[model samples]
Target: MPKDKPLNAAARFQKTLDFSAADYYDQCRNRTYACCFSVENSPYIWENYANGSEKGKACIVFEFGKLRAMLNSALNPEGAILFYNGNSCRQIFEVNYGLVHYVPWGSHRTNEKHLSNPILYTYLKSDRFCEEHELRISLSAIGIGHFALKDGSLIEFPPTLQLGFDFRNAIASAAIREILLAPGADSSFLKTELSKLRIEPAPTSEKK
Candidate 1:
């Protein structure tokens, strides 16, 4: 696919879908921004090729778009927050289960919606998600306090999956929210943790 083809294809896809317009729109949103729904985690083992300085440890690479999706899903906002990288953000901590560390990865989409679709490949292959990152995107679908589904279903949040979507996003999501919003939360925690690894932008850097 080329830079100027996704919207046309997606728009065509939107018109041809069998689901409701809302579902159709969300699908388009996720597809156009795969990173918004997926993550690539790896052990911080100083694998410079993968984690240049982020080594001898463990961490989750929150896909930029995926992080947005997670937060949007949690916050239950209208559409994309339009959150771009380079814009300084505060770190939230003080929750339980440690989801507090899951912050947005600092990489922005250089091109427009028509340009090379954005992706988070470097972290995808960072050797974390493949091995231990059982990030179950399904958990993100419902039960999150921030997200009010189209069907009006607000159930209990699931336990946070160690790396991905293994247990419950509801519980994990709440914890994450607490951490980020907690009074004690600070930037040092995130900066120190983020600096531990060498994150790379998606090589393909495009969505399907």
Candidate 2:
């Protein structure tokens, strides 16, 4: 999950849109899952994400195009199928990817145009985090199984769901470029673990 500053998606729309619109946006957002990455492998990222941990910290460098292709192929092959009222329906399962746009707080104002596609708000962020240089991959399945119907009754599913992908296939596809261990990470432990999996760890680089 990606955390944002206070003035995020919902806050940006609260003042401009009506209550219903805002509520709908929140519902849609709840069904969305996002993964964030940074273009730069920086000390700031290690300080915040690694938390000075001495173990279990590593930054994976991925070939973005191959990664995207692998995700699309593994997770949403032939689109996603849904059951509504006992009838099967097909919905395109799309993964949206783009750079995060940072702007001053309160600069984003919702308008009539946004009503048709409010999920665009997810990619916006407060300028305070500009140093992150974030690239985000998000999947929004607003109608997954939330409103499944069976024999004239609503079949409820969990509000949140987990999605998985083929990790071994991703690695085999040459999606991973390198795996950089964080400063002070437990190199011996990590190397041994990776070795057991037959993975060769990249050489440790001098800390910045």
Q: Could you tell me every candidate's TM-score relative to the true structure?
A: 0.21, 0.70
Stretches off by above 4 angstroms in model 2 are 1-19, 77-93, 112-116, 143-146, 149-161, 195-208
Best by TM-score: 2
lDDT of 1 by residue, 1-208 (tens): 2232344344433444644423433433332221222233333222332232332233343434444445445433342222213332222111111111132234332234433312222122222233333332321231112333335553222333222322134324332221121223454655565445532222455412
Off by over 4 Å in 1: 1-31, 34-50, 54-75, 78-133, 136-208
lDDT for predicted candidate 1 compared with the true structure: 0.31
The top-ranked prediction according to lDDT is 2
Clashing pairs in 2: none
- For 75-191, candidate 2 gives per-residue lDDT tens digits of 674665654445765543457898988877555554523344645677888888988989999877664234434455654434554566555565677697767776567889877
